[model samples]
Target chain A: MSPIASNDGMRPWRLLRAALCVFVAVCLLSPLVVVLIISFSSAPFLQFPPPGLSLRWYMLLFSTPAWMNSLLVSVELLVPSSILATIMGTAAAYALVRGRVPGAPFIMACLMLPIVVPGMITAAALFGVYRGLGLNGTLTGLIIGHTVLNLPYVVATVASALRVQDARLELAAATLGAPPWATFRRITLPLVLPAVLSSLLIAMILSFDELIVSLFVSSARVRPVAVQMWSNLMGDFDPTIAAIASVCFLFAFLVLLADLALRAGRSLRLT
Target chain B: MRPIDRRIWLLLPATLLLTVAFLGPVGWLLARAFTFPQPGFQNFELLWQRPVYLRVMGNTLLISAIVTPIVVLLGFPVAHMMAHGSARLRRWLVFLVLVPFWTSLLVRSFATAILLQRHGVINSFLIGFGFIDEPLPLLYNLTGLLAGCVQVLLPFVIFPLYSAMARIDPALMKAAATLGAPPLRAFVRVYLPLTLPGVMTGATLVFISTLGYYIIPALLGGARQQMVAQLIQDQIATFGNWGVAGALSLVLLLATGVLLALLQLTVGLKEIAR
Candidate 1:
């Protein structure tokens, strides 16, 4: 198709359109740019275009006990929850994809219930149950809650990957005298490992950033970084949070990069 | 056991986890709503009975309605540009959208706070330029809340629409032009209808998510502008009223279900998910 030629009469209209596009792009990206700028500011108060630059806020984030402890709690919660979610998710996805379970669509939707339901309801509900079970204000409770939230991601990714896999490979392994577990371990797992890993990274990102559930399930002793950040935001407009926010950005970015690299490697292997 | 039967065991672990952690808890909350504060439908009735709760419900709907169209209007041009731009430009534009999409909600809301605060970036810049005599009340208002939400949700709208728009056959527009249709008329007739699925998808997503949003409004909106999620939080966290909170949640859930069903009826559920 020939490109639509901008006639002489349309030149001003085209120029205006380009200007509008540029303005919209700037507006959309400004907040992220502003966060980065404020993160490096030396000002104790939230200020744009810092009068001076210093790494002290970043340093302070790591050195302060409250922030540092929350970070440790976050990582502690993130690792266990992601691992748990990935494991459960992989198994459930395999069953759904390969087992040919009846009503799989409905079951998949049921599993995704956490995603659709508002976080406030989930948080409050978990608060009530955890209180009953003596799991409230505990790291285990946080891990369990986060795992439930993360399970759907892993299941979705791995189930899709499983959909594209050849069942014949597993059958071939079974025909070669391998047990069911052996067939899965030797053939199936390796094929789907990349999707599983990608889901794991996503689960980690979600767990690290999760706040509402953590607010309800966690105590002062087991606070996640996001919960801590939320309180700090509510209590005071702390600029140090800008440094912590930057760190959160770095974590999310790294996980995304890892996910991309995994997908790329999978594609390369396929080709 | 049969092969399928044995394989069903694979789902057990996850089912067990979900049953204990998720389903059980939410069920408990709903059960408590009926039984805790003298039972029956009193709590549900309170939703309609109380002016505050009704106002919050209205506020939630109003914000979602406002934010959805704003995001769609603002996002249409960018998505259009991305669909039509050069490969390099498309990548950069997609990156611009993705960075915010993946960035922490807390950070974005915080950034919005800085920009919307009395002496924050936008205000200060405007003041420095002598655009205003005094700092405007941007934060702690609906304007600030909308600013935070539209930015956060814009990418969600743009992406689905961009995918749909990119698949459009540009030749159809050229054909319309060859038939003596004006450019504007051709675009309106040919391109717009084709992108309806994307528009519906993005609008439904932005609206549904906006209904449940808590952080942005909590941080930016005025005390009077409390949304449903905040109302639920207040009932639980502030008032410690599980009964009313659960009732409020049910209202929100019903609203969400209706929206999803409406979208599903128009565009298949799978398309919207995509």
Candidate 2:
């Protein structure tokens, strides 16, 4: 570690490095930024550099029936499904990490099965599972499907964080007359809160952008924005889609940014 | 807590979740694939009945094999550059690597369509450069599909390698150099072997992901270029054959699971992720 120095405090080198970092970050984030730029373009066609910017496209989004319906569908599913996934995923994370479970690693792998499993399979599998239960094309089915898909994030990330946590802390509290529930509520909950919040944010973004599963299982009730965008992209290149994508991109971006900000705030508070 | 009591009781829910929600469904899906469309291995019949299905599967495997190597080739240098760079620079590079990650997959696919369309940017640029008389056939074809998928999947391979290369001990490289190995040789012999786990991780990650990628192929692939995922989709949605759809889905699931198990055996997850 000592082998490296901060450029021996070389100001010019430091400045160059800072510039390089900024350039790289911009390049990496360019796609999202480009979408944002194109989304606000006032023209009726997609172009790199816009002649002018207006809220007309966004206005189009609000006034249009199809666009509004898709947005509504996205929200309706994301809100409740995120909640369910958080609870179930968090419980599963706790069991996998803290519990004296047999074959913890295998369980962790199973929890992460969705991420590793192709979405096509999950789509197909759910098509089978959801149909057998009479939940296919219904909100309940979509919830079950989304929950299973997004649960991996909450479990994997939170469990990794929990694995580093001290087991003795809760035991100490218990010895001092704190009840099991109180110990969890006071200590474990707060510590894992950051992971939980970020997980929720990421999961919501995932369910919102998810296309394959929705393509299979969903119908008019929850035909998400992604489906609309996919259809438009396939059949025709509509400028309104660019606009809708821009808004969806912005909405998802804010959620992720807020998640990062939230994590930062927690670390700051802790420090 | 007693070991057996705590372990068994606590794991009860996890086991049930795995068995019922994940594995049970996945296994049932695979069984459906074999016995689908009136039972007795009719789904596997696609392997022989439809050469197009086999061709598509081959195309899927071939494209991934192509993409994986290129991803590794391109990703390694980038990862190396970021790993050895100053922390300030590396952090920014990392942020750059992650930026496309947060964007919508569908949006990227659309952007790819716009980029690769016959009269789109690439053709426009080539025409401007006076490279060709006419626009090249790009999007809605295999060339465009591969291009779009590689762009999205590049990050998967890169991120894992970046993390792995970052944690590597610089001293080992220095040690190799001290023993008279040149920097390039030292990197090839010393660094590359250590990073094999990352390579495997990245490859498996991309292979498994590219296997199920729907948006990229749907938005970019031509009529003849559709992958298994799309085939399954069409079978279920357009053709209205749940049994066939169920069957094909199982094929992909089993293929992916077997590959994943192979990855674990080859790379050993503990070394890379942990």
Candidate 3:
């Protein structure tokens, strides 16, 4: 809250800023908007001037067994991987923050290194090792890969939340005849709960959108949506790809929206 | 320190999982690339002599160098504007930057293909406007690949730089201005130097990600412009050339490590993106 609101109007610089902002936003949103419209198209093919609108394309998506199976697989992988990644990340953050573990900085770096390294390289490297160990084409392998990639985000987000925490709050609880477990259960965990939720949602998104690693490590058994989309693209640029993509967009939006709502509610509780 | 707390013991599971899942894969692959059965420098030597391999490496570096600096140069003005703009306006700009953030890179690349192809919206628009007799070479080439890469990497550079720029206090700039330094000079002497850490971060993020990308080149670039990642991918998936694939993989891994380490230790992007 600045005292000065800067509420003046009709400035040249402001107009220029508006134009640039509008252009970037339009560029970002228009592709998905176009794709969403075409998903409801009546044309037999991915025709640009789509003949008409209907839910037939979506119905077609639902009817296909392979598409249905892939969607199910994506959900199965996302939920478990997100949960596991969150747990591991929170535990690691707690350990590193609370204890003077030797080589803590280096350990933190190693835990979050996948975020910096290119996914393609990581995918290739993982493919070789899994194939060597006979872990390729299994749901177990997909979970392992997805968890590794998502863990870093969880660590970073939860760490930030934990770092902002007040130590005296825990000390205050301890002074009030509270046991260590009670203090942690009643105070420490609650403070970082929103961050935990945020990390989990982000993990789910990462696992959902992942394509390159799935392409390498997975086969027919556990194909994620992104992997299935690649086969559809290469097989002949199937228009159902767009239909499914729209479904995915909506799906991701809802999940993120839900997370934001949860965050707002949680903060209300804290206040 | 106070013998490990019970809560702190939770770290073992995470450490063990990372060891098996992440570091295990990476370390094992690097080692396997060298000594699956026996060790030798022969695998790496081939990486140097193969013309295609050399050309692809050059292409990788060239693309990274070209695309990153250009994005930095262009992104600075926009990020700077956002930093000083009204709060409401800044929020809208951030949303604009992040809308594509939610979408997968695969989806964005596909859209870029549709937008830039010969019969795509862009070429068709220009041809329809009588700018050229023929549809200009827009898609399935070097130029198209560059265009898509720029769009993808722009946000990565912008976010970090914008974060840094937005943190600069306005009072410092006002002081410089009041001391008879023109606005341009004040920005050049004060703001520019202060934001070098951000510039370094943006450049590292862009350069590293660009070096390891395969999709943009595979979809948009012609055969003449194949990058190192594409070459390695083709070796394994297309040709099933295991020995060459291993060699190429090692070459890429070592090259990126050495380059990134050099950049990290010397130029110091640690304070920025890391």
Candidate 4:
């Protein structure tokens, strides 16, 4: 590292740099912090530095069927889609990494199309196709849509991990009289398991947070929390949404914290 | 032929799933865009001839253009700090970045609504402090839309830029300094040029994502300020005009394709997966 670029050197510049960093960080984080505070407000409306602390909104959120049902719907879709995406993604990653699949690059690009294309386009297209297939507004449709949306992340993560892994182990196992399935199960799968799990978790998060596609594909019978939140924001302004935001914030935080813990543990094992 | 390659079989399930579930729908939409409503490029003609359709497209591009530079300007310093800081500081900075990065986009948009509304935090503070006699119009406008977009895209810019900057040797800067160049000159001449790839990558990613963004623009940008996504949704949801919607989607798909191709050339295909 350059001494001039070091934090210890150039006092005024360092101070300015430190201030800008803190300012930007605070600016980025302020909204979430404000939402957390507002969720606790006893007042009926969104009041900042809220009137007083209470779990009234949270209680209200749980008591309301629409909000609670939406939450349940989101979880239902999140779990199935995450699992489906993970399985497909892990398989695709394996093929791309080790399989003698022709046109691996083209296949990888196609897999990533969902990530690159605008989501509204996907949602609209699915809306039309599902209308014909009688799948629109069904939970299965949402799951399929979400699984496609999430497949890329899982594939990328697992594929990157597989790229760095030593293939010699799989070769050795096969040479030592292990069948293909046995070699994969005992050697290849075990090594990439952590990344596969990470991809699953990340896929779950993506499904949970998805809004635009869900807005298009979901019906009143199968609305996700994000769709519910969108309708709620448009129709009314209330702290109940704040309460819901806080619940989501907490859910996302816990999942991310778990992901971090998993990563840290894996790194420690490697070291 | 002891055993067929398992890899080929492994790819089959995903390929089947994507084809049936994912590509099938998109392909159907593309087909409908051509044939729907007794159509023969009428939808495309509508997009080309209509003033409102053109306006939304222009608005989407304008907002992205405005947001990209601001995000880069704000992201550069933080990324610089993260790249060059001590390990402990780097850890803290990464946490600060990742928390927002991982936070739900819906939650972030809602927070922006709460913070930028007429009586929201910023306006309320300004009024209370007597800085303004009346609340300034912030929400449901371009300002609110930009705020939401920038926050969402900032981390995208920072991470790529930081990665690129980190790869550069500090010794080059030190050498420039030793050769009697001033600090600013060294940065502008040596350090800046080296980090150009990162800046290009971050800027392009932010722009492309912004162009495709739906939720923030839909929620924070109110009915008055319609964007391309909103227009497409309106075509389908309100008008039930699938042909027009499909046509609009094709336009967006084409734009995204071109930009992504550019990204591939500049940042490499591997950088995109990350």
Most accurate candidate by lDDT:
4
Chain A vs. true chain A, TM-score per model, equals 0.92, 0.86, 0.91, 0.95
Q: TM-score per candidate, in order?
A: 0.95, 0.89, 0.91, 0.96
What tens digits encode model 3's per-residue C-alpha lDDT throughout A198-232? 99988998899898888898888689988988778
Give me the TM-scores of chain B across the candidates: 0.95, 0.88, 0.91, 0.95
Candidate 2 off by > 4 Å? A1-30, A265-271, B1-24
Q: Which stretches of candidate 4 lie over 4 Å from their true place?
A: A1-13, B1-4, B271-274
> lDDT at B212 for candidate 2?
78
Query: Candidate 1: misplaced stretches above 4 Å?
Result: A1-20, A175-177, B1-5
Task: Flag the better candidate by lDDT, 2 or 4.
Answer: 4
Question: Which digits, one per residue and each the tens of the lDDT, describe model 2 over residues A1-271?
Answer: 3322222544564465456445434434555555677778887776655678977778887898987888888888888878877877777787777666767787777778878778877777777777778777777777667777888888877787677677788778889999867887898878888888889898898989888788778876667788777777767675677788777777776886798788787678566
Best by DockQ: 4
Model 4 in CAPRI terms: which quality?
medium
Pairwise lDDT winner, candidates 1 and 4: 4
RMSD to native, candidate 3: 3.4
Q: What's the lDDT for residue B214 in model 2?
A: 76
Q: Any runs in candidate 3 off by more than 4 Å, and if so which?
A: A1-23, A175-177, A259-271, B239-247, B254-270
**Per-residue lDDT for B124-190 in model 1, tens only?**
9999999998999999999999998998898888989998999998888778888987777887898
Count of backbone clashes, every candidate in sequence: 0, 2, 0, 0
Error of 3 at B80 (Å): 2.2
lDDT of 4 by residue, A139-233 (tens): 99999999999999999899988887889989999899999889889998888888888989899889999998899899998999999998998
